[model samples]
Target: MFTDEVVDSVSIQSLWRKSQQSSQESRGCQTRVVHSAEAEAQTVSATISCTQTEPQYQATQQLFPNHDELEPPGLKDFLQRVEDTVIRELVKNAKSHAFDGFQVNWEDHSQLVSCLHCLQHPSAHERGLHVTSVSWSCTGSVIVCAYGRIDDGDWSTEGSCVCTWNLDRRALNPKQADLVIDVPTAVTALCCHPKQPALIAGGLYSGEVVIWDTSRTQDPVLVQTGMSVDSHREPVYQVAWVPMQKKGEFGVLSASSGGRVLIWTVDSDQGRLVLNSAYALVRQQVPHSSSSSFKVSLRIRENTVTNQSTLSEMYFRLKTMLVHVLSLSLSLSGEVQIFDLGRRSLRPAATIEQGDQGQAATCLAFNCQNPHLLAVGKTDGTVGVWQLSTDLTEQSPRESAQLEQIANQVAE
Candidate 1:
């Protein structure tokens, strides 16, 4: 059961004032100094206005029932408060640690992954390394990719490999695995496409991007190479495939170490496979690049069909594209930018850098069921979920309203 509580006027004012104060604190001294005089004048004017309306406001406040005293905050308010508290705590945890990572459970709760006893000095013939990249496949299995030196004394030689873990059984068991690709360079990034169960993409330390089809256990089918265009000069950080449409037109998008985003289309025509680069999106061209921290994160969404009696004829007649590419990029300074395939360039969709400094966003994942919801993991070991506006310029009001309702229910 749930109930909504009408917030008291005084409480609302207090919350607003606190938020303003926090904003002021986030701004540097120059901005604060510049706004101080204006703030004082505005405060005096507000004081005079409040004095004139104090009696009327008190009268109105008295006329309303004292629901705050009787019912307090119900389930909705409690859940919102809990979410705020969790976000704050995660931010604090991230600020305190340098080596941290996050993993989301099946229930969507972000949990900090433990890195215990995994770092050890390699013996005469072995190397000691730590897990650098991780991915979860459709089969519910976890794969950890490592990159480091082979031994404590031998820094001349480096080794990297993918270790598969059976998450369902809660054990690291790659000993009997049928296939394992050994790379001469370090593993920079790894991703398993949502629709292509047999395909896996890996970015290497040598600045090479390799796509592998794991259907054949003995040898993986090499589909494409990403190093020729200098797209992966430093290292490939992230790779993902754009969600496919009903017509089966799909493409893969990858973000490299140099902050370049490349869109590669997957063509399956005439019984052959082809991966072609369609677009290259750079982040510096977008607004607010000075405050950004990381490269763009890519995601895809599938539109749904719904029924509205009054608009059914127009709805069915209107052709809607099912697939879209949504990218989230965090600037090195503290800005998050979002872009879509239809847009001319990337834009700042949402920013969440307040109270977070010296922290780097390491990973991002989107909710399969809710495309508007996204989870971002930072190097400080904190994960935050963000909800986007459901109003779609290309979608109907009924669909947007439904999505808004779902988001509201989930937030509550």
Candidate 2:
């Protein structure tokens, strides 16, 4: 999936404080990935050596009980410890392997590095700026920004807008955005189309999902609302595009804070992009005529209708496809729940209880190199890595081979 520009070697630099003795003291760490000339080598490794200059402090506070505090007191201390541990681990791993080595002078230098570019909103609002979400286009040429924050006092959707910038043209023309669409609701989540760079999906605070065509951003290309169809009641927190299962079909999955996940499909019919189907994330018990305890409610076009057996069957079909769905939810009590959209029950497949000391997970990401490896970041700057294991027999031979290849590359 990488183009020549992307496959080229790149260097990454991380900045951190040099020691606890001084808050102003800073150091830069850089790592470069270069291609090896050996035909037999599929991967290359490097060893970096850096001297530690400062003493680390110990954690002074105990882990707070879940019910004992609304906010954790030891969070800052815990984060500092995590940072020191990370630096130590990086140095250790760099020295353990040897493929090629280069020296970088870490001596403190006081000089300014030129900023390559900058992006800003065309119009400023009375409210403070809080870019809650951002996503890059598939080709990496465009960037989409969403604006809003629940914590912002006097927050309103009046200033909330979705803007896309063309990186290639920005250097030559820095005054205006490539595309700007005023959204009615505060955009909380954004996801670019995996196949189409021009299509951008945005989730709003009003529980609406709007798809904007960046090519012409004055208005949204498609809008899905809860009033017209089934949707989330709470703010949509995340929107992600699912891998396409069929040819000429596009699927998107969105998750809201109200514990709702909706799978939406879009298709072009008669030269118009239309919503083909929307399946709500819900659970229903199989109905029995002899039992009179069956109750059903569905929202349709601003009206709620009560029905029983048919809707239950529809939910059953949705549950059957849960294997392809991976939804994550975090509780204020420091619990992380992973829901399987393919399961028949609404209960989570696995739950990670963060006993007293931990805070709610703030972010989550799956490893591109290994899909089964998941990493979550907590509000306190603590990160947890979880491995999603499956039976060996469950994986096809092609998948098994790919896993083995990745293992060999890591070993190298």
Candidate 3:
């Protein structure tokens, strides 16, 4: 590197002091008025550079810090220091009951019941299509209805429609639905997704299981089980959503009068339902036992049974009991069968005769909030609500022993 030198002027001060010598001596010493001295007018100067000459070094820091480096010093000590204080605060909170009496009772709970809203689709009604199945969304704010010919036994080319209504909407329309999905055939069963608010599964009269995403405006069809070997040969009476092995993915469980209950995984890209598992519930395999006649029929009615797949808090072990609402359309006794899945025997654990004992039951459902409340629909287009006795839902040693004795006898 080339260096440049800068010259700067130096300043000097001249001083004079008063002297104690006589004026004569001062005059003799100061003989000349001005003194002149001549010599070489050059000065030697030294330049020193202050810039560092040592070699410069540069190093890059790592983008990600090591795990050991992330740990702070004396972490155990810090936690120990605050541990006592935290424990003390927690104990104090546990001893306190600030929210003990803040219970809110919002249920009307009146013995009297009333109708809220009767929703209908005008086009479906005009086409002589009646509702075959109805289901509520997981949020309990939306209701889905499947319209089909429940009375027609033969094959129908008539088109049907699925309708949904958002009851929470401010401008609720009873004569119209928020969303209407048209179907080529009658919809036999309808079930809303358990967790998803927009997903809906429907079983068609043609034995096709379809999943519809109401959120999609262009095409609500997410996936469908078209005419294939896996498809049911008869009308599907029930369709339910089941959890899949993968997280956040749901599969469909469909049952048909053809004695098959099939489970399918939705393949969205392929637009089809892939068969995952299948179960055959054949009515012909009914055991002709010498003691009891157990007519195990999957056909609850010509149409889908109301709440056929509903799980009750009775028998499936730890309140997972499944309530089998048997249809009595062919029987005059109008009996509803309660099958306890907790037991292996095919006999119903308990029999309930509610409403008109002679009337035939078309469908039935139990209230989820109250186990004692049961609603039964008759073949004569009548609905009856019955409140069961407390002893029926509760544990009775006498009933248990009686059932056990019967089971032992059957075994013998």
The per-candidate count of clashes, in order, stands at: 10, 2, 2
Write one digit per residue (lDDT tens) for candidate 2, span 1-412. Answer: 8566545688975455445445666789878987677555467889999887443332223343346556678887889879988999999988884433222324221111112334446452234444556666776656666766545445355547776666667354443556778766678888888778888887888777777776663556664544444667778888878765687667666777665556666644433323333334334633545542334333321112333223322221211111234456666555666654333346665666432454554444443334454444343323344556442113544445656774585455
Q: After superposition, which runs of candidate 3 have C-alpha atoms over 4 Å from their true positions?
A: 1-110, 287-412
Error of 3 at 269 (Å): 3.0
Give lDDT per model, in order.
Answer: 0.47, 0.55, 0.65
On TM-score, the stronger of 1 and 3 is 3
Task: Estimate the TM-score for candidate 3.
Answer: 0.49
TM-score on alpha carbons, each prediction:
0.38, 0.41, 0.49
Candidate 2 positional error at 75, Å: 45
Worst 10 residues of 1 by lDDT: 311-320
RMSD values, in order shown: 36.8, 33.3, 31.1
Order of models, best TM-score first: 3, 2, 1
Runs of candidate 2 with Cα error greater than 4 angstroms are: 1-115, 153-159, 170-175, 267-412
Highest-scoring model, TM-score:
3
Model 1: lDDT equals 0.47
In model 1, which regions exceed 4 Å deviation?
1-126, 142-157, 169-179, 226-231, 244-246, 266-275, 278-412
